[model samples]
Target: MPSPLPSRASAAGPVPGRYDRFLILGAVCLAGLVLPLSFTAPPVAIPAIAAELGGSPVALNWMTNAFMLAFGSCLMAAGTLADTYGRKRVFSIGIVAYAIVSLLLALAPSLAVLNGLRIAQGVAAALALAGGNAALSQEFHGPARIRAFSLLGTAFGLGLAFGPSLAGWLVQTQGWRSVFLSSLAIALLATVFGVPRMRESRDPDAAGLDWRGSLSSTAMLALLTIGVLEAPERGWSDGWVIAALIGSAALLALFVRVETRAARPMLDLSLLKYPRFVGAQLLPIGTGFCYLALIIVLPVRLIGIHGLSALNAGLMMIALSAPMLVVPFLAAVLSHRIAAGTLCAAALLLAAAGLVWLGVEAAAGSVHGLIAPMLLIGAGSAVPWGLMDGLAISVVPKERAGMAAGVFGASRVSGEGIALAITAAALAGLLQLRLSSAIGVDGATLTQAAQRLATGDAARAQALLPQLDAAALVHSYDAAFAWLMYGLAGLTAAIAGVVFALLGDASAHEPAALAEPARDDRIELADEPAC
Candidate 1:
């Protein structure tokens, strides 16, 4: 079957007045800020949460994973809903739902309850993000539209840049619950400011949602994450672990079949036909592992194992994330001078170098030595973070720009979720290797010890293994962490080589292909198709 054309909105109703613009921007910006804060803040609170509620490392990992996996999985469907329904209506409902979920999260009684509520929170995040971005496209024009999106990016960056520190402070002074309370306040403000001022908009010819494609994709990611997260706890050869991995593979095949068969597929599987486009998608996955994984992993290492206070851990995280605020703008400027593809590959190389440096410093137990390497990683990752979205669509035909953007966005967030799961598992597995060889512990005892120590719960791990002392556990952790870093560096360097080859010489022609859109509206013109 031929693919359905993307929908186009009818002429927008009366545009918001000056006062109304502030309300609209304020609401969406707040919503934007809430997304990253909800995502990045919880890792710092994991040890605290585990202390209070009691949870295994797998369950603790889910506190962040569940939210991200659900958010990334449901994002395409949420965008479809916004278009089929009304942007304003969907945005309103999403903010309200976010507020309610945040409130419930603040009062979560158990890890199970928190994880379930986190899923709800993730869905709400998807709704708010999809609706808010769709509404912005309708309300703003030309430079105003560019400025609006720039502000949205700023809010998102600010959340990422400061989320850990703020959460650290809250978890230090108030409690882990205060992080959700903070999210609740932002959602409430977004509702008050945005819901009232936003004008309703929707595509007149939006297609029905692609339920088969959406469900299959979401299930595939869920199963894969579950399989990876559980592998370290239950040995990879375990029957249940095998079943989950096999189930995920089956769902992956199902997702491909569904997308290929659907009239209006959530992702245009055909886009994968372009080698350059495939390379572009890898950009996100590279950062997801090299950068985003550390957003959670490092905090656990610092606060849980190193025994730093939450506030100090958050402050340390700044060296790893603060460059996001400035470097992206710098990248946007530098793209005009350098080949975007060359720039991206160089950025990854820089991150790889930083990772190696970090491994050396961390293994040596030098806290101050970590700062420069962390900054380098942050800056290097930020360059690609700014350029990949534009590169995704720019490499595709203009008609499929909407599909390319949707796919890239999905890949970006979903890749981060999968990366987090895989990286956490790898850390635990490596730690297990060291623990087993050093102490001859295996099975549940070995798995439990590795998981706990890997996640920054050294006290519990020691309790579980009476023969293991604090010094030994810390030594094992450093060894595992060093190996994880070197492995990531090698992976990143290899990705850089592959991307460089796939995108060879395209950089020379990129400027001409991108110039028109950059000069015209600085965005895709097509209305987003329903997923």
Candidate 2:
């Protein structure tokens, strides 16, 4: 039988109390903050940047996509590096690199320079983010681990939920350059505090870095991301799009084959053999789709259809995010008594109900109608997001914690990217059909108009004005929201079914598998007496 999980008091080791872990948590979370800040800051400053840089809407899209693509692709590589080298060393290096890149971004003279810096920043972010969960897994265990993990989830949630609003305000109060400078300062501080206090954690017995696996994975992700981003602008049938799809599939197939045969694989294919692990990984994929879809769809609906300013629209979306803060804590408390899978299923149901209410509200054309639904969705999402990491990592051995952490993080990021692509396709297709029918124009003409409008080419859109009407545009938006609602509902039902069917009893796994160890290996090494 496996041993029971260590309590919070024991998990802290010689640090004195549970509160001591907060400093380390803050340092780890600081690294994570950069990612959301970078992803969000550009949207607020896009118009100004375009005015100065003379780039089209596609150029601006690349600014964000480039970072996300690089960051997502590099995560597996970073994880391997952390496991082979020391986590603290890699994390600190990443922090320093991220800060330097942010400064470079602030001083970038042209769009090309900025795009290059964004990719560098993403590389740094991938290194830092890939090891965060492993650090926590090594440092804390049992109920303490649960609480610490919850706080980590809260930090990420707050970053996504509030990063854009903060960036918007910064752009308004200070220049766009201030955003990068501010993040740079935060990264520097994290490095300063983290270097002396943070201890290294990596299993010396782990396999060497999987270069082949990393390369194949990165190539696959880049091809896939580029294909999705381009598909909306280029026809799905375009040669370039088709080529990207084929290349991505081939690379991914190669990656799977490589992992299966590698002496020390980057991804442990055996994890999927367990039902709970599979369910845990899949739940995040589904939830990520719903979470990002609602986030993107709701804001666009509010700003474009209702004529609300960006700031106001972002604030309104807070109705959906505010409850996320509380639900995780509640879920943590509930997890002591109920199964993690059961809580996840319940959360999905609540989120689905919220989505349904949101659809009803949108169909009726009342902005105020969305508030309640947003709250429900927010509350529901909190628990599952908080619990997902724990669920995945719990099933693995302590020695393989870094591998588990790497895989879990990769799954969530990949899921978010795939979700974004799927949601974008659905919304774009629906918008085209509805607008074309309403405006009495062919689909091709309507798509051109929509593209012009999306790119902020008001003059061009006005010149083509006779081809489309205001009512038609509004109808197009309404149709997109309708599709989003249906997607969310279907996603929620699927999540519920998976949870109930696959994860009905959490106790099927050895209790020792669920419990934290007596001593944190990371802390033990850090506190060892010098020879």
RMSD of 2: 4.1
lDDT score, residue 425, model 2? 67
Residue pairs with backbone overlap in model 2: 2-512, 5-515, 5-516
The parts of candidate 1 lying over 4 Å away from their true place are 1-10, 14-27, 43-65, 86-89, 107-115, 134-154, 157-161, 175-177, 192-205, 390-406, 435-448, 459-473, 501-531
- What TM-score should be assigned to candidate 2? 0.89
List model 1 lDDT by residue over 79-98, tens digit each: 66666566777778888999
- Tell me the TM-score of each prediction against the true structure: 0.80, 0.89
Model 1 accuracy (lDDT, Cα):
0.75
TM-score of 1: 0.80
lDDT string, candidate 2, 1-531, tens digits: 355443222222254244546667777767666667777667778776787776777788888888887887777778777777766667777788899999998898888889888999988888777666666666666777776676667667777777778888887888788889988988887776655566566665566788899899888877877787677678688899899989999998999999999988877777666677677777676676557667766776777666778878887889988976788778878888887788888888888888887877877777878888888888888877777766666666555556666666667777777776667666666666666676666756567766554433334544675755565556556655666687767877787788767765552112224324453332223432111
Q: What Cα-based lDDT does every candidate model obtain?
A: 0.75, 0.71
Candidate 2 lDDT at 82 equals 71
Per-residue error for 13 in candidate 2, Å, reads 11
Count the clashes in each prediction. 0, 3
